[model samples]
Target: MKELQDKISKKLGFGCMRLPVRGEEMEQIDDELFCKMIDTFLAQGFNYFDTAYPYHKECSEAAIKRCLVERYDREQFLLADKMPIWLVKEPSDLNKVFETQLKRCGVTYFDAYLLHAMNKDRIRDAEEKGAFAFFQQMKQEGKIRHFGFSFHDKADVLDQILTNHPEFEFVQLQINYYDWDSEAVEAGKCYETAVKHKIPVIVMEPVKGGTLANLAEEPASFLKELHADVSLASYAVRYAASLENVIVVLSGMSDLEQMEDNISYMREFCPLSEKEKNAIAKAVEELKRFPTIACTKCRYCVDGCPKQILIPELFESYNMTAQFGESPATTRLYRKAIKDRGTAADCIRCGKCEAQCPQHLEIRKLLEQVSEMFG
Candidate 1:
């Protein structure tokens, strides 16, 4: 009951992962646009902002420092910067990363600090590097107000981490209506596990990185029937936040329109009506009609792809191609991204990628579809 009642007002955490990019490079966050977006976010009373050392183009933390810390008062907004264990190679590297984040954010202290993107491997690495002790030290030093982790792993891994470290104040998970029953993510299962352990959940990508918002005909039409004014994006974020123990739901608001629409939902937050819930469930069921992989470009497949083509990216193009019909311009961009990577022609029919795939996807077949669509 305490967890439910302890709703942080405007718990709309601004995710700095996918900020508005300049052309193909995510490194270049459009300063004018992003600053405007930030200004709008702060003015509206939403406080939490999330960024990490390598969130955007491997230079996102610095962008946050420039755009946020220097711009907003320290007490007005809460900032959460995560320690990137995956990027650390040594035990001492942990301190280096932690300090780097502090320098990058240009803040003496962090409102919330998390062990970023804890998978099984990252968890193991953190254990070896005395990660928990480091957070304990930071807490004593007053550098961090709260300590936690953002996770993307199986429920067993989540359980292991939570049980092993009950001191963590919260857990961040990717939760959304589309990912509820998704085998590739199992967000619902992860959410339930957090509840059993009585941990507050910070939801990231509640709208599937805008994938749910820019829906196809079936979902768009179906949701339009439910509430003409309510965007499909609203249903996704609301569904995630409505879950038990959710402390905040983070949205990667890249533009003014997205920021306004999302904040609107936060202010007049409404729990999903039963009819609304059914509409969402039905909408998700309809979304599976599109043949897109769950490849979130988490960089899991990058190393395994023998052809070197960015597989997830090609899928993004594939979805767009099907959505907008054949336009030479669309295929041209896809071609440029894959030109050096050898189009889909260089897929060696090797099963190494398939072995590592959590989706158990038929990668070779996907390449053919990709080639036919864009080549």
Candidate 2:
């Protein structure tokens, strides 16, 4: 595994989920910008790219094929793709999807392939469909070099999965500081489970989907005082990278500035110091003081909301006012966000939003709070 780590050489991997888009359209990926970012990433000596079936509304794989696979030599970079196990209807659907993934990525074989976004229900579905055995056979057939699964379940489920199928070479996990000790995500325990099984860890959501990157003023200020130079995001990425078993930390770089910022710090990789960790601890303590919404801005709730509330944006405004006391400004922002859609008070308690939320938040209740605060 250590030799495998040395083979890749760089600790950063370009995540394809949030590729730079042209204007407000996600499907229309900015190819020129993406090409530039990839060029810089390669120039700075990173060699890993991770994409999935559903990222960018199913466009991420094809974009990487055009921007990366077509431009760079196959040996110059390693590509990691995934099977959308949830989309599989039966066991035979697995191979059909794998073939499509390869075709979409313009590759004969993937360097790494994963079972995308597994929880207990999804994993069980995969098991019933014999998806795990399918990947193992694919490995034997030289279709995939490394076979693994990206997890979104609890520690106990992770333990069961690893114990039941130890063939997985690596486990991609969400491992940011905010969710490190979160009872909901159980990130800390999940990481520990992977380590216990000697599975090499590949980190996803190291910035908590940009939540840790764009910190609230209080914690950001504390970190600024300590480092004075590093971006708030650097601390989060570095913290994930510093862990012993983490082989790659994926960041979904959105623009040239973000790409350069990531390259600047990650080009010369360094671990977080004890003093920096202490600062993060203090920031966490301070963050706990606010009645802030614990939203990662994943926008999962938005897809199912009948009222079309811009839930994440509203929560951001709520946070700005409630946590940082930027009320007037946040009030204005809130009004603007709700201009074309439903306000916090407009939620009809349909229960669809809560059902879809990965965080299991009482979104109905939270919306009532947002209404009280800003309505």
Candidate 3:
């Protein structure tokens, strides 16, 4: 276990969720730019690349295969993929999905394989369908080097999963300064629980899907005043990396510029200084003054929305209006988000989105607010 931990000790990883896309089409990856970003990430001594079955409208796996797997030696990078447990209807579906993932990524084995997006109900479904045993079987066959799950629940739920499945090698968690102590995310409590279980953690959404990076003026100014040079995103990533139990902090770099900025600080990683920690605390307090929707833009809600609403994008536009006040720019953003898609006013209030939301957001109610603001 210690030897395996040493192999992935580099604190930075490349997340393939938000690859640079052409225009508004999520499926159309900008391959030239993505390849360049991958090259830079590799050159900076980072190896871990995280992708999932549903990232990039289910195209991220193949994109990684072409850009990274086909272009470089297998040993040059560590690839992690997740089994979409939501797609499993029976035990046999596990092998079927796993085989499809192997083919999609064009890899014989995965460095890490996780049960994607495990929560209370999903955990129960996975266990009942023998998903845990399947992972162990894959590990024994050398198809998976490390087996675990990415979680989206409170601390007690995490504690339950770890207790029930002690065989899991690690866990991927959503950890950012904003959500660290949040009642919905319980990131601080979740991290503590994983530590108690002796489980190494791979952090996702360290910047809260660009929320912490693009803070409201007051908090953003406070952080900038503390460190004149560093990017706002770097502080959030560093905060997650600073934790003792974290194995890697995954940044979903959309372009070369973001990748370069992340590499600059993460290459020679440093924990937050005492003053920096206090500064983050103050910033968090300042952030609370603005009542923005706490959407991380995971896009989990979009896949199942009956109206096909771009829920996260609309919330982002709404947040811009809430934080910086409405303007032509914010109105244009809202229009762009709903362009050729379902607008906020088109929502049917069916509640599919609310069921899948990890943050447990009142998405229906929030969409009404978005409609009122931008209608």
Q: Which is the leading candidate under TM-score?
A: 3
Please identify which of the two predictions, 1 or 3, would achieve the higher TM-score against the true structure: 3
Candidate 2 ranges beyond 4 A from true positions: 1-4, 326-336
State the lDDT of candidate 1 residue by residue for 67-169, as single tens digits.
8888888877788889878677877888888888898888988878899878887888998988888889988998988888888788888999998888888
Which segments of model 1 are wrong by more than 4 Å? 1-8, 297-308, 322-333, 339-341, 347-365
TM-score of 3: 0.98
| Ranking of models by TM-score | 3, 2, 1
lDDT of 2 by residue, 1-375 (tens): 454567676889999988999985568999999999999999889999999988887899999999999998998998999888768987888989999999999998888888888888888888899987788788889889888888877899999999988788889998888888989889899999999999999998888778777777777888999868878889889989999999999999889898888888898998988888999988888777777788877666786788999898898888878766766787788888798899999999998887656677899999999898875
* Candidate 1 lowest-lDDT run of ten: 1-10
lDDT of candidates 1 onward, in order: 0.80, 0.86, 0.92
Which tens-of-lDDT digit does each residue in 1-375 have in candidate 3? Answer: 565567774799999999999887889999899999989888879899999999999999999999999999998899999989889998999999999999999999999999999999999999899998888899999999988899999999999999988888899999999988899899999999999999999999999999998887799887899878889999999999999999899999998889889989999999999889998999999998888999999899998997889999999999999999989999888888988899999999999999999888999999999999886
How well does candidate 3 score on lDDT at residue 187? 94
- Clashing residue pairs in candidate 3 (N, C-alpha, C atoms within 3 angstroms): none
Q: Estimate the lDDT of model 3.
A: 0.92
